[model samples]
Target: MPLKLQSTFPALSLFGVLATLLSLPGLFGCQFPPKIDHGRYTKLFSIFSTEYKYECDSGYTLVGEEKISCSDSVWSPAAPQCKALCRTPEIANGKLSVYKIHYIEPETVTVQCNTGYGVVGSERITCLENRTWYPEVPKCERKILAGCEQVLAGKHLMQCLPGSQDVKLALEVYKLSLEIDVLELERNKEKAFQEP
Candidate 1:
């Protein structure tokens, strides 16, 4: 009876050791949590009641819960989703050269004002990671041309004008000639005053 009791005792000890080793993982929370797409987690173990924080990658925004806690070997509140978005920019008196009507993050667009309007900001804008444009939206303002500048611009336009299209060119030339005549009269008046 003593020999049988010794053998049974050794067997019981071995079984106890095996059970403890098997349960060690549960005690230390050794299970790995599920991966979150487009995001990363901070905690190594997903033990019960352990919280894990998640962050989205560049050009992606987190949606739903930012942190999830493990419960019953499963993450609660589910993993947050990373969504990409790009807000469309608004520009007054200007137009954007975008390939897609719906904008996306990290995309580039060219901004230009209409004819006779001046741009007050950057001509190119890039979508940022936060779904906002890097530079502020450009503004287009009506160009106020000086009298001489208008005449000069008109002369340049005339150079490009076809010979057959004379109506518009002739009108601009007539206006310039009238301006020249008025300047000559003013000069003559100044000359008369100097002589006296």
Candidate 2:
């Protein structure tokens, strides 16, 4: 009876291929995940690479792709940045002249209405630090200038107050202002005396 020895070349060859493929990444200098300021990413595993889904914190806006791929242990493209900005404002029947995913704080946007519609509120709105829009969102009110419906319906588009009423209201306002001024003067005098 003759004993035969089996060569492990086939198994060893497969192992060598895997080892070289895995070591190639290290040889080329594998990269760690890049740190994204004001943002975070979640790791997703893949067969030959890694993926990350990024998200900006509250009050921060992401400026790049939400998902990024890392092939051969190096991230593709550049990491996204999180910017402190206000979310886009939604205005019914109107649109902003310059639309963006987010707006810088204190920035102003122009509002435009569709055809046959008229702007009913501020034509321009400013973004605030608190992410709220100043002067509120505008609306596109259907134009009624072709007819007298708005005026007849007393929509207040045209003023029709009597002269007597206007004078009376003005006098009342003047009296209130005078009283306030007197009170303020008296308070200032008292404060001066106390300071001395």
lDDT of each: 0.72, 0.73
Local distance difference test, candidate 1: 0.72
lDDT minimum window of 10 residues, candidate 1:
21-30
lDDT of 2 by residue, 15-93 (tens): 7786656444344355655778778987664434556778988887777778776565576767887766877877777
| TM-score to true structure, per model | 0.39, 0.36
* Highest-TM-score candidate: 1
Query: Model 1 residue 44 lDDT?
Result: 34
Runs of candidate 1 with Cα error greater than 4 angstroms are 1-83, 148-185, 188-196
Give the distance in Å from residue 26's predicted Cα in candidate 2 to where it truly belongs. 37
Q: Give RMSD to native, each candidate.
A: 11.3, 14.5
Candidate 2: lDDT of 177? 69
